[model samples]
Target: MPATDRSVTEALHKRRSVRAFTGQPVDPALLKEIFAAAQRAPSGGNLQPWQVTVLTGEPWQAVKDEVAARIAMGREGQQPEYDIYPRELTEPWTDRRFGVGEALYASLGIPREDKRGRLARFMDNYRGFDAPVMLFLHCSRIMGPPQWSDMGMWLQSVMLLLVEHGLASCPQECWAMYGETVRRTLGLDDGQILFTGLAIGYADEGAAVNRWPVPRAPLGEVIDWQGF
Candidate 1:
C-alpha cells in the first residue's frame, strides 16, 4: 500500500504512538519525500533548529546492538544528557501520566506485579521495537527554549508526514538515557544533544499493544474559550 490516503483531520485522529512494528523496509525514495515534507514545519525565525540522523541497514543494527548491550549491563556508566521529565509532577499532570501507563500495560496483559515483564518490555525502546528504520532528532546546545519549540513542531511534522505515507512512528524519549552511547556511536559532536529518537516502519496492527486507544482529557477541562 502507498502512504496515507486520508485527509489531515482523519490522519490526526488515526495517528498513534505505535510500540510494535513489522520488519518491512520503507522505500528510500518514500523516506526522502516524507522527510522533505517535514521540512515545511514552522520554525522560529526560520532557524530550523531540528537536525535528524536516520539509521537503517547495517548501521541501524549496529547501534541497536550497542544500546541493547548497554541496557542489559544495568545501564552502568550512563546518565541522561538532560532531564526528560520534570522533577516535580503535580495534580492532573501526574494523574494523566499514570493513567496512560496503566492503560498501555493493561492492553499488553502485563500485570501490575510483573516487574520483570514490564522492565523487559520497556527495554524494547532501545531495540526500536524491531522497526526497520530509526531516527534521532538533535539540536545544538546553544539553542534556547524557543528553538526547542521549533524542534518539536518539526517532530510533529515528520510524524504526520509518516502517517500520510502509510507509515507509523513512536517518539522514544527513552533514548535520551543513552545520550553518550548515541553520540559516540553515531559520530555526533559534543555540541549536539539528542532531543529524542523515532522508530518508523509499518505498525504491527495485530499486536495487542497497538489495539488500545489511550485516553485524552476533555477540551473543557484543558481549554478556556476566551471571547468566543
Candidate 2:
C-alpha cells in the first residue's frame, strides 16, 4: 500500500524498531523528500539544531568495517560522549528495559544462559542490521538539554516520515558508544556530538527478530488526566 493511503494513526501502529532489514536500498529522491518535509518539525525558537550525515554504498561499509575491527581487537572503540542511560536507572524503568530485552532474545530462541548468542546478536547492531542506508544524527557539543529534546523530536519526525514512505527504521543510541570513530570517519569536527544512528530500509518482515511484539505500557500508566 502507498504511504499516502495510510492515516497517521495507521502509520503509528505499523511502525516498529525493525532490527532486520532486507538490505534493499531506499530511493535517494524519496529520502530527500522525507527529510525535507521533516524540516517542519517544531523546535524551540525555531532553532533547527539537527544535523544528519546519510551514508550508503562504500562509505557505510567502511564504517562497519572499522567498528568491526575495533570489536575484534577487544577494544571498546572510544569513550562515549554521553551516557546512553542514567547511571541510576530504577524501578519500573529498569524492569521495562529488561523485559523488552528478554522478549527479543526469546523471539530469536536464544536462552538467557546463552551469553555468546546474546552478545553476537547485539554486535549485529554495529552492522546496522544489514540496512543499505544509515543516517548519523549530530549537533553542536554545546547544545543543552532543551536542544537535545529538540533532536529527539526531529528524530521522531524522521521515523514517522520513514513509516509514511513504506520504509522501516531502528533508532540506535548504541552507535554513540563509538562516537569518536563515527565522527572521525565522517570528518565531522569535535564541535559536534554524534547523537545516534538510524538504519533505514525495507524490513525483513519474515525474520523472527522483526516478528516479535514489543510491548508498551498502558495509556493510563503513563498519562494522568486532570480534566477532559
Candidate 3:
C-alpha cells in the first residue's frame, strides 16, 4: 500500500466544471498519476474500452493550430461517426439540457440572439477550452453501445482524478466532429475512434466564466431506492 493525503476525498466532493484555465503548465508526474487512475475504471465483462492520448507542450499547440487553420477555411469539418444527442429528447430531459445551455451562455454573457458569440465559444472546445492539457479518448471500432457506456465510466473516472489533483476537466462531446482529422494527424490506428476530448488544467480563478455555479437535479429527481 502507498500513502495518500486527506485532501483526496474533499477534492472529489468540491469538483466543478471549470471553463477558464491559467496558462501555467501542469506537472508531468501528476498527469501520469491521473492516467493511471483513469485506467482503474471498471468495464463491461472486464473488457476495458478506453484509449487516451494526453497532449501537452508542443504537441498540444500543434493540434490547436491545425484545428484553427481548418476552421478559418470556411469548413464545417468532419462530422461525428455517431450521433452524440438522441434523435428526440423528451420532457424533463429536454428541459434539463436546455437549462444547462441557457445557464452556460448566460455565464459567458452571450445573449440568446448572439449566434456568433455562441459559435465562437463552441469553437473553443477544439482549442481545448484554453487549457494547456488536452486528452483525447478513443475506443475500438468493434465496441457496441455497452462498451460506449463503459467508456463513459472511464471518462468519469479520469475527470474525478483530475479534480482530486486540484485540476479541472471539461469533457467535450463536440470534439468527435473533427476527431477524424485529429486521429489522422496524430497517427492513430484505424480501429480506434475518438469518442470525446477533455480539457484539463488548473482553473483560472479570476475568470468570470468559472465563477458561475450550474445547478444540478436533486437526488429525488435522479434516484429511486426500492430495496428496504
Candidate 4:
C-alpha cells in the first residue's frame, strides 16, 4: 500500500484522539508500511530512539487480561517511570483538561455525578479501547530529554500516517501509569522505558464518545511574534 496523497493540513484537521474503534482489523502489512514511513521523522544526529511493541490477537488479549486482573486486585500496577502531567497543572492548562473531560462524559451521557461510570469508562483505555491493533512506544533509559522529544515527533508522524491510511489513533499516556505491567507483559527489559501506547483501528463513527470535539487555543494566544 502506497502512502496517500493526503495533504498535511487536511490530515491535521481530520485527525483526533479516537477513543472508540470498531472490531475491524488493520492489515499487518499496512501497519509495517505506516511505521516505516514514520521512520522519516527527524531525530538528533539520525539516532532514532523510538522502539515499538505491536500487539494484536492473543498478545493483545493477554495484555488486557493482565491489566484487568491487576486492577481487580486493587492495584494500579506500578509507580510511573515519569510524570504524565506536571506536579501542579494550573491556569488555562487545567481548564483545558477539565473542559475535555466534561465534554467527553457529556457525549457519553454520563452525568457529572456518575463517578463510577466515568471511572469504568476511563478503565477501557487499558484495554486499548478495544482497538484492533495496539502499539507501545518505548525508549532507552540512556536517552535524554532530546531523545524523548524525538520520540514525540516519531509518534506524531505515525499518527498522521494512520490518518492517511484511513485509520484512527489515540496516543495514550495513561498507559504510563501501568508501565511495569506493560514491561512484564511485553517482555521488555529494564533498559527500555515505556513512553506511551497508541490504539489504532477504524473509528466507530456512530459512537457518541467519538462525537465530542475538544477545543484548542487560538494560534495568536500561543504564538510569540518576532521582529520581521
Q: For this target, which candidate reaches the highest lDDT against the unseen true structure?
A: 2
Q: Give candidate 3 regions above 4 Å deviation.
A: 1-9, 72-76
Lowest summed lDDT over 10 consecutive residues: which window, candidate 1? 1-10
Residue lDDT tens for model 2, 3-119? 652577877888899999996778999999889989998999999999999999999999898777767766554558799999999978999999999999999999999999999
**Tens digits of lDDT, candidate 4, 110-225:** 99999999999999888888999999999999999999999999999999989898999999988887788878899998999999999999999999988788799998979998
What lDDT score belongs to each candidate, Candidate 1 first? 0.88, 0.90, 0.80, 0.89
What is the C-alpha lDDT profile of model 3 across 157-185, one tens digit per residue? 77777776677888887777777667876
Q: In model 2, which regions exceed 4 Å deviation? A: 1-5
Candidate 4 stretches with Cα past 4 Å from truth are: 1-5
The backbone clash count of each candidate, in order, is 4, 0, 0, 0
How does residue 148 of candidate 4 score in lDDT?
Answer: 98
Q: Give the candidate order by descending lDDT.
A: 2, 4, 1, 3
* Model 2 weakest 10-residue run by lDDT: 1-10
Candidate 1 residue pairs in backbone clash = 3-165, 3-166, 4-164, 4-166
TM-score for all models, in order of appearance: 0.96, 0.96, 0.89, 0.96
Candidate 3 or 2, higher lDDT: 2
Name the regions of candidate 1 deviating beyond 4 angstroms: none
lDDT over C-alpha atoms for residue 49 of model 3: 79
